[model samples]
Target: MVAPRDNWVVDGLGATHEFDRLHAVEHRHHHDGGGGELHARGRTIRDVADVLCAAPLDPRIVAAIRACHALGCDLRILSDANRFFIDAVLDHHGLRGYFSEVTTSLSRVDADGRLRIAPYHDFHAGTHGCCLGTCPRNMCKGQALDRIRASTAAATGGKKQRLIYLGDGRGDYCPSLRLEREDLMMPRKGFPVWNLI
Candidate 1:
């Protein structure tokens, strides 16, 4: 069955919408210990990961990814989603090998098996200078795009590859600004990013 637009599953805690596994675990951890109205209901991050791994990928998207790889295109995934979810989805769909690089939020499970999520570029540390001030505190996709472009150019003997960005979120706006006139931005129609652009 097709999941909801937000990909949320209704649990005993009523309507809880978690975008990724890390957030789901964090939510459960917050209420699990309090004996409150909302609890984990014995679900862990591992369970969330398993569900995400089993989630199906669109065959069209997988075919497009394979076609890009076959054509010698350097495929990169820059997502605000946590590493666990992104990696799990890609690996599960057998699309991990197509990506030249994957950048995502840092995540780790503690000794107690509680998941911890951190910003890729620590906002408290003043790591990024996003003039728009619209991106998330966890990461500035524009800065990450700059770094990726520079690194790609350096590795490819100073020739910058053309960028074709496909995004559907508000965070994608900043990076869309970074793209050159020659590059293409494929923002999902009716999404915040499309409206912003």
Candidate 2:
């Protein structure tokens, strides 16, 4: 799954080294309600988005998206990022309608416009038996890909469809392994997944 674009979060925030530090803490403490400290810092989700969402959309990616949509490629987004952030980016570029599906961490804006995000699978409330060592505990992209394939099969009367997965992270490795012989995996060059392969 693709997290919020790096340009919006990391570099845009001028905190290149802070992402791992921040994300690691969040992942570990999320189930334990350890995020109270972060909120106590007076930095709400809205505040972050207000700054990061101002990054200009990449034209090359936008052109590619339009081309794929025009060709009826059945586009979808599988992202680790929350919907609020993804929607904000998509809405900024008027590209929200281009995708048939967007699978991500669920999010909603509270009455006060604070973004509340939840894991796609509640890792704390119930058991999620991934059995694979490669994925984040909150959600497994391989399982998610399997579900997407099942859904598409149901939609198309059980016809087999080839898939093309493009990703750039260690969490993405699980889904890459799920690809069949006929499917394609495009790992961004020099990224962790590519290095791993």
Candidate 3:
């Protein structure tokens, strides 16, 4: 539930920061919105690609993701960055290979009720629309975690595995709230959710 932060929603043109609702993306040319306006600046697939390609990769997180893979934990990624943008970031960081599954709000449905796969970053372009009710924020972490539970049941013949989630933002609060009493959660450098527990 990593909400866009810092450069995540730079200059706030067509971005929203909520986890359960559309933040109502307003273009810079539009009249009103919060957090900022969605400027066409750095909003292109190519533009974002260059930035991600140049951004420094977080080695610690990378190692954590890799360790999850090595331990046979199903590693999945859910992000608000349209699938293409997320992929570009991952691809740039060389972390794409670490995730077992990736889901984003960029899925598009056509008139024929078929899915139209657009590049993750170009999803905001005209001639197409974002997937209906496809906001990653619409996906509650508990629900996503439930799917993981089901998969584990199928994989291990009904054996239950402990789940530990680490996050650092307001959106993460909901998912963290759903964690088992013994499960672990934390805010990067802010404060400990456990302290509140």
Candidate 4:
């Protein structure tokens, strides 16, 4: 018999709790927490995974990502989504191997023992301030991209490599701006962030 569908992410707090529970279980099974994701995206990991699996993924996009991986280019995912969910989605689409690393905010914690979403002033001024705010882990896309660049540089004998980022949301803005000429940034159609740069 088919099991009943579980909806763990009934609310924001429920989502967070779900992530924490999964992480705890995974930690016990692996017996090594260091190798897993550092940023936590929600309260529970499975809740995040459920949402991703329920969503429809584009096969063409998956193929493109796989092609990039075949070219010896690393496919790294930096998103606010919880690590478990994101990773599961990739695996479900047979694209897990494409990504060299995956970073999610659900894996990191702040000094206050909560998610660390950076508080940065907008380009305008104090009046138009915007904070990424506290996420599940310190796993903001900008920060993850920064970490990826540094790690790649270290691994590739300090060679500066190009970056390609794509997103359909406001969260993609800050990270895209950080890319250089060699890098590529793609945003969804009608997103104001795309026009700003």
Candidate 5:
């Protein structure tokens, strides 16, 4: 399943609900909690990173990703996961160089190697101005896609293009609404976003 990167990485897939408790307090008080992601087993950052790195990566998915890059597609990641986790996962799977840019909602890792996630939009400051209620408080995938499209157009000297999105979460639904007639929206079967469509 495609994990939601907005609030956290995954729900049941090795995600640490322990960090959620900390995040809740931090989010409520609008302050830093000085904590990064934690494993469900209460392991530290290094241990979790090691475990996640050792996790099995499906070969079929990796090949598909490789094929897309081989086709000269400009792959970009718009993940809610922190840069550290995303980079670690991609690098471990030998898929880091396939993407051109990663528009992730995360701050840099601390010197101590803790992965501190920054909101895509600062919830404490103001709203993301999105009417789509499906969007998470940390980020709006639709707005981010618009920015990416604008940048792509600018880079191509205003040339038009199409998009093919493959996603399976509530946040992914907002971006599907932004797709044009020529764009493809491939929501994973039985996911919340698929049912929403």
Candidate 6:
């Protein structure tokens, strides 16, 4: 995760960083509920699209994504970020063609015009067996990685592909543990995962 900079301010999307523009939404309503319930009014998908389109993409990363796609690599994104934001970013950068799959939090606009965000997997429903409690209740990246591996193998006629994980947050640590010796992990050098490793 990027360290909090002096210029960083909390946006309506509840993000404190400048680069995370995907979470920026019009916060016209707010709510506090027990047991992971959120009652905040949400912006529409169209609103999110506007914010994401205006967000800048790193040219280097865009080039890299294109190169990976040209090589026929099976690119996937596993993120705790909301799907709307992730999708918008990919579309904005013209990098959507590079990724075969993207796993992220589910986002939707409710009838009351509230943006509802929910986890892809609810741990409260049942544990994912992550020995480390570092991950949030919404997801366990380790488990997601296992499922991805299984599906990838199944899709490729039981031939396992070499895995490469790139992440920066503490949530990434659990998934890193699941990687085999042949796999590669690229954690941001100064981020929590890299420091922990």
Q: Mind giving the per-residue lDDT tens digits that candidate 2 earns over 17-60?
A: 45456657665423232123334445566655765567665688
Model 4 bad stretches (over 4 Å) = 1-51, 107-139
Worst 10 residues of 3 by lDDT: 29-38
lDDT of 2 at 4: 60
What does candidate 1's lDDT look like per residue over 108-175, in tens digits? 66665655666677755774678786676677888888999999889989985899999887889999
Ten-residue region with minimum lDDT total, candidate 6: 28-37
Compared with the true structure, all predictions reach lDDT values of 0.67, 0.71, 0.49, 0.52, 0.70, 0.64
Give per-residue CA lDDT, model 5, range 7-121, as digits (tens): 3333333454654665676553111323344322454566545655765567887898999999988888875455666777887788889888887667665666654667788
**How far off is residue 165 in model 6, in Å?**
0.7
What overall lDDT, based on C-alpha atoms, would model 2 receive against the true structure? Answer: 0.71
Q: What is the lDDT of candidate 4?
A: 0.52
lDDT of 4 by residue, 1-197 (tens): 00111222223224445445665775421112321222243234444356556666566776777777778877677665445445566766777766777665333444534432222222123322225433222234566577789989999999989777777555667777678889888776776556554
Among the numbered candidates, top TM-score falls to 5
* Evaluation by lDDT, superior candidate among 2 and 3: 2
3 or 6, which is superior by TM-score?
Answer: 6
Candidate 2 deviates by what RMSD? 3.5
* lDDT head-to-head 4 vs 6, winner: 6
> How would you encode candidate 6's per-residue C-alpha lDDT over 8-116 as one tens digit per residue?
2124334334223322442211111111122232435465456556554567877887888899888898876656567667776667767889887676667765546
Q: Give the candidate order by descending lDDT.
A: 2, 5, 1, 6, 4, 3
Among all windows of 10 consecutive residues in model 4, the one with the lowest summed lDDT is 1-10
Q: Which lDDT tens digits does candidate 3 get at residues 2-116?
A: 3233244332323444311333342221111211222222244344356545555557877777787898876666443445456766776667777777755453333533323
Better of 1 and 4 by lDDT: 1
Error of 5 at 160 (Å): 1.3
